[model samples]
Target: MADNDVSQLSASQQQALEQFTAVTAQETKDAIPLLRRSQWNVELAIAKLFDGEAADPVVEAAERAAAPAAARPQIPPPSPLPTPGPSLGAGSRNRVTISPAPRIVPQPTAVSRRPSLLISLLLFPFSLVWRLSNSFASLFYTLFPFLARFRTATSPPSRTQTTRRSQNPRDTAARFIRLFEEEYGTDTGLEFFEGGYAQALDLAKNELRFLLVVLQSDEHDDTASFNRETLINPEVVEFIKTQNIILWAGSVQDSEAYQVSAGLGCTKFPFAALISRAPSSTSNSQGMSVVSRIVGPTPPQTLVLKLTTAITTHSEALERIRATRAVHEAGRAILEQQNSAYELSLARDREITRARREAAERRAREEEFARAKAEEKVLLAKNRIAWRQWRATTIPKEEPVGKDTARVSIRLRNGKRVTRRFNGGASMEEVYAFVECLEYLDESATDEETPERPGGYAHEYGFKLVSPMPRQVYELRSEKDGSERTVKDCLWPTASLVVEVDDGEDNEEGEDN
Candidate 1:
């Protein structure tokens, strides 16, 4: 009320008071308690000079007027209620309802008072160490392309040292696996091997040993005892080979298999436990690739799943695989050389056959020419004899030729006869030429060059006990089946050489002695 109104007001204004309160506007009239209303009694001055009583009145109603202020009150300006409007289009059987919101869950305490320190630390949201380790590993893999990434991870902070988990191990593994599978998927590239694989095996020259585990299959090759549909397929082998991942077949023996399992941190792997030997530093001749399989307590099929999971979680085992798939380079080289030699030998044989055929043809032509010449010579000799007879009969007088012929006979060794005949030629040139041609005709001239003796000695130096040929001498001879097992070439080791005088002496020599 205004000051003038307050002064003019009756005793009821004496108790009037101003106070703040909260209530539903609809119930504003009745909501204000009678006692509180009584506080607004006697002229019931809301404030300043008032012309009306308002259950909800504004403080501005108390104007600076000393006279009573004009006041009018309707239901308090519709208490700002939310406007109801059409929601979007869809219709549900039930009207769209906004149910009470779920109770807000209190955020987990950063430091839980109930948890042990170790538990809290372990469960700590910070995987920074792991992330960093992973990043560093990924960087290393990228930098060293040939370094086959495997399950590589630092043991979780082994006591004192900070450990790093491969932050992006999956990424690295996936990359390696992709590359490996790509390379190995080819025929004989890196797959289950049989006999031919043995030859291929000879080509590997690596720091580690690669063992192709042959998981058995009962469908076609029933020899395999491992479960069907669970065979260690070529894809797995390719994956291993591409990654330079060692292909190891698990062993049936649990203890022996445990070594592999423990190393892999898994009970199963892609391969079956059907191997001749657990993958080790040793070499194996058995066709382990396709013959052996990965066998475990778990069905063969499940082994792969477990193994994959293990590899995902563990990194050390993967590195071990990389370390083991090694090839034997030296042996492979030797085998290649042998193959080359064999091929060369085959080529040489083909050339030799062609040459022999050509030689035979030449020989046949030469022989035919000689026979015709010989027949012509015989006919000429007969005609000369007939002409001589005719000349003797017709022109008996003039002897006009100075011609002579000489024949000599000599006895030779071996009771053989040697006859020498000289032809009456005008000069020696003709004979000399014939002799030269005869020498050239000798077939022995066509022989290949003789090999020198061992120890760089000439074959002409025959005085030595060891022959220039240096033939392979054996100590004894023993034959088995049809082949000769030995020869007595090294008999000199026990026998002494000496000149004997017991036999083959003439009677005259005996008398002289």
Candidate 2:
């Protein structure tokens, strides 16, 4: 076969050819000829390789050897080997040995095949019954539309439309008025608002007016006479129109009107109730209060007098409530203004306090920086002086041996005497620096050291080093030749240095100057 032709074989075909050659103990050179003759079919080449008579006995022997020893059947005698079949050609006579056949493993069947078909057949009758029942129900509903409501009632209940129907008070009252006019004629002079009882109550509350609710039952014997004689009276009609009142009338025929009548607990027919706004402290439930109620028929003058008295009493009460509310509002305004002023003052105080604290912090930082600089300067000066002393360059040898240095004794204000030996050639500035260092060291040794002060000294007083024995004040001065004198030139071998603290006035003057 061509080299490219071998590459064209599928993976399974190549694997099967390798397994076939291994089982038959055949070389690729000899097997390829046989495989090509069979069109590279691995199973066909395998069958042809074992087709001779010699292979049949070897296969039978392997099968017998592989059987379980206990499962082998007992026989009277062993049968003789079968005679070889007649060979037609040299190729057919070629014997090829092979292993036993591979064991066959059963696979599980798919769930969607037979099982699904059976389930479908089992559920068919139930599905048909359900469809038939639904069809009959639909037919019944179509024939009697009203009966559909019963079926719907078994479902989850929803909000009814009655609430929306009753919301429009004006429409409901207007319809009732039309019905009343059709039944009894419109000759009565009593004017009524086209609204429900709730609307009338709300109007009376907002406008601070009275509400007149008239409930009439058509079955009552006195309803007609009461409306004609008392309600339609000129005096009653005039009072209702002239006074701060809203009249709302309804008949018992309407369901809404009957509900209102039942809620009011009215047993008598031709009932007239005067509703008004109660005092603020008193609870006006449902936004209405029954001020006066007249049951059955009564004279027009008596009804007018009762309405007038109730209106006067309630009007005076409402006026007092208005006055009280006005006073409370004024007090509340004043309190709010006072509280605003207090808050402003508190904010101002906080700002001032914050500024003072920040200033103090800034001063502390500046003092700390200055103290650090002073300490560095002192350390550098000490290093320079020690280097000069070690080099023996600043010592004056011209003076007498023992008198080469000056012994200066200083007396402090606290009655403490401090004496130290200094170089005779040292300048007066050195003498002052030594005194300042001594005072700083002394203050540090004490417990009452004030670190918040700007400088190392406790007091703000200036110091003047003087010689009391010579009666002369020592001052630093630059000569014309640009040369300054030292402590040795002023007070030779020994001198008494008295440190005098300046008074407040002298210190202030020195600062000013």
| Top-TM-score structure, candidate number | 2
Q: Once superposed on the true structure, which residue ranges of model 2 sit more than 4 Å away at CA?
A: 1-168, 182-189, 280-287, 324-513
Candidate 2 root-mean-square deviation in Å: 40.9
Q: Stretches of candidate 1 above 4 Å error?
A: 1-305, 309-368, 371-375, 384-513
Score each candidate by Cα lDDT: 0.33, 0.61
Using all chains and alpha carbons, the TM-scores for the candidates as numbered come to: 0.19, 0.31
Highest-lDDT candidate:
2
Estimate, for each residue in 1-513, the C-alpha lDDT of model 2 and write its tens digit.
342254676787577668657655677655655564455776566556543212346644664787665664432121222333333242122211111111112122224444487787998999899999989988987899877544332322122212323334566688767776775678666568877676676777766677888887654556778877888888988889898578888765554555666666566777877776554324334444666667777889989887776665456545544544554566688899999999999999999999999999999999999999999767655554343232232222223346667787888656678777777777876666555444344334453533332233222225778888767777655454557668788766888988876565232211111
Cα lDDT tens digits for candidate 1, 204-307: 22222333333211111222323223333545434555544344232212122223333223323233322112222134343222112333324533555433
Score candidate 2 by TM-score against the native.
0.31
